[model samples]
Target: MPDPLGPLSTGILAEAERRWDLLTAADPSLRRAVDLQRGLIGRSVQLFETIRTTGVRAWPFNLDVGRLRSKLERGVPLLRDESWTLPVGPLTDALLDFCRMLEVSGAGASAAHISQAIDSKRLDAGSLLNASLARADCDIRDGAIQLGLAPDLLWLTAELAVSPYAYFLQRSLAASLPPDVLSTWDRGDCPFCGSWPALAERLVDRRVLRCSLCAAAWPAHSGCIYCHEHGDAFSSAAIDRARPERLLETCGACGGYLKALVSDRPLDFPLAAVEDLATGDLDAAAAARGFRRPALRKLLSAQTPRPS
Candidate 1:
């Protein structure tokens, strides 16, 4: 499908326009999120393009497959950490440039300014990079802490740190892993990272869960990927303007909502960041029905946070 997320794609642009129409037709309470999605999509395009640029491969940390297998078999999360050091100077600079794009797009002007102060005087790259790392680390540790951080800045650092591993995994591991390797993990969370599905989809005979982080998709556990509650009692009905391939699936047990893309064909890999934005109306519809994404609850339970 020529990378369904490409912002320049006429198909995707048309899809974006349609989604916006759905959002506008719905209630007004979700305007901020829908508008935020509009901004987020552009930034996601910037990041994805950056990731796919020639010779921009991420680091290849050795994986302990035996351990991963054991954990998967036990329904335990694989211990994935973003500890490998990266070129902070370049990453920070790129992040700032992205924030500038955000400002130009009218997304997060104040947050961009807050992040821009690191290089306000156009100082040496080392100093600015160091400052950026410190700020990024602060949010990774404690999201509640207020240190004049922009949400965009936090997201940028997270992408810079995790996307490499995710990209590397998508390249070397995801496709090559044995199908039986996942026999034991049929729970609500990602067996690889324990992250919940930001978006999900049901194919002809089975469903898939796409991780909010890592952008990895795996077979789902039948119903309620958030709480694993089995039933047809979800608030995920398709409505006006919703395509047959997409809808919102909100679980009543956990008050968790997810965007599901239902299709008759095989499920495709999701452009997680862009898909999240693209499903803004599904998010609004789910929220309007009083269901949340469960990211906050999932965040509070785990000390470490990944993209939601």
Candidate 2:
């Protein structure tokens, strides 16, 4: 037997498949995007662990600024200089491959358009890199709009190409932040990348924030750390009480739902990404309950957030 689901990630994949079927049953458009993302999660984990670790890393702290406001405020972002350039050619090729994988899933037409665009040299690695970084600098949802991506294939083309670079970037930035500096950055967003966390892990008694883009992990305060909307306004998800390790925290004040994974041990970022996709039921349930990201976002807090 080939172990149909495999020993590793069998449970996560199974749950994700169930969630995918349920989510797409109501909104068919999510099917291809979800499937494509599922495929890339494994690749992303591998890439993050394999990228050049030594030469491409730096601490982004700035003394003149006093406190970190934005990631770009202090250091040069990847792809801006010759020393920090990404493997743009490989990234573009990967996106095309992911798009092709969507062909059998009734997204053949979308795949064809993306393929044609790439074949005609209408898209190049440098242009794609420029668009992805620019998009990350702004709102994530607005990436499709700002990048002028095709309407139907947001996940397959633009996001896929950008994902590898995001993983590589995460590893580089994660290495730079020291424990003391990380502890002082008591904010919902990553101190290193300034991007929102994809998930938070409870490492024994301490909880750490993991960046969605750069994969940087740092400690944080519990109870709606995202919007600072605690008390009666916040609530843990009612689903799967047996699995308390994973939770979807919804804050009524900001209507922002953050995915939280309470664990006794550290978890891998790549594996966490897989689990992030698997938690679509939580996302859908939150959406059905009118939970959403805050319209006017406030990702960071004042320099002092504790009893100091």
Task: Write down the lDDT of every candidate, Cα atoms only.
Answer: 0.55, 0.56
Worst 10 contiguous positions by lDDT, candidate 2: 299-308
* Top model number, lDDT: 2
lDDT of 1 at 227: 74
Query: Per-residue CA lDDT of candidate 2, range 208-253, in tens?
Result: 8776655567677767877676699988764678867678888878
lDDT for predicted candidate 1 compared with the true structure: 0.55
In model 1, the clashing pairs are none
Model 1 lDDT per residue over 1-308, tens place: 33322223455545665656676576566566667556555544445555556344443445666866875676555534324444544445555655565565555566465455545632233333332322233333243134345554554544544443343345445544566777777777766556667777677787888776555667887667767777766556665553767777778888887788875443222245545665677777777878876542232222333211
Identify the runs in model 1 with alpha carbons over 4 angstroms from their true place: 1-59, 74-76, 87-90, 120-144, 151-153, 160-165, 232-235, 264-272, 296-308
N/CA/C clash count, model 1: 0
